[model samples]
Target: MDDIQPADIRLMRNEGSLRDFLRLQMTNGKARNAPAKPPPPPQPSDHTPGAWPTGSRPPRPIPQAPPGAWEAALHRLHTDTQTGTRCECPGCDPTTGSHPDAA
Candidate 1:
């Protein structure tokens, strides 16, 4: 296979043509020799383990409302406890059968 020549690799690939490359290389060479600026110091963080600022708790995640297994189980328990069509209101007894699990 023939190796692609630099001429063929120019403006076709958004490459700075040979002239732009030469200028960039010269500029890069000068910058490479210059001293690098010192890095900035790290800023202090408010993060503290087990401690929240102003007595506030860490933000809870947004409620997705996507029921997980526990939520499903709780819902099942709640639904199962509901006496459908039986009218399981308070002060009603299992024998009376107003509410299934009111007791």
Candidate 2:
């Protein structure tokens, strides 16, 4: 086993048989079946836009803020509280009133 044996090594260089060797290697190691492909990614707007989807109604538009009354009052109240002044209302915020289960 320790001796340099000529039979141990196949010293047949390229010898014009490279094409045959590659063809044999390729055909011998082929996958039996086609590989499983991954499922495609979800498309944007599976539900169409502009109008509502099937059987569902479009969402209602949010009510607009009244001209200049309540918003100004709330902002002033917030500013006054921040500056250490008392709330002028003397009661709870009526527009966005607190509730028992409110977060």
Candidate 3:
């Protein structure tokens, strides 16, 4: 018996030749020796310790407002007077016998 050369092996694998036979052999070999798929990932269960109940979500913590919030807001409003204008109403007009502080 003679040993086959690389050129001869390539020629046997050319189009419409022994290529399909070689591919089939490789596929069958892989199917026979491939490892089984790992078990499905563990699922969360109600019976499991520390597991949340089904169809329910964990409670979210309530947010708290800081102390003196109202006083801080009032301070901001009083200091932010860029839009302030003198009242010109008859009751509040300083020129119509009304004090400027009345406005």
Candidate number achieving the greatest TM-score relative to the actual structure:
3
Better of 1 and 3 by lDDT: 3
lDDT of 2: 0.54
Clashes of each: 2, 0, 0
Q: Taking the tens digit of each residue's C-alpha lDDT, what string does model 3 give over 28-92? A: 88998999999988775545667776777889898777997765454433421343743433333
lDDT of 2 at 72: 68
TM-score of each: 0.22, 0.29, 0.33
Error of 2 at 58 (Å): 3.5
lDDT of 2 at 19: 64
**What local lDDT does model 3 show for residue 71?**
50
Model 2 per-residue lDDT at 83: 47
Instruction: Report the alpha-carbon TM-score of model 1 versus the true structure.
Output: 0.22
Kindly report which residue stretches of model 3 are placed more than 4 angstroms away from their true locations once superposed. Answer: 1-15, 41-56, 69-103
Per-residue alpha-carbon lDDT of candidate 1 for residues 16-102, written as tens digits (9 for 90 to 100)? 576765677789889989999999876448656566665677888987566465544443443323434433244444432334444
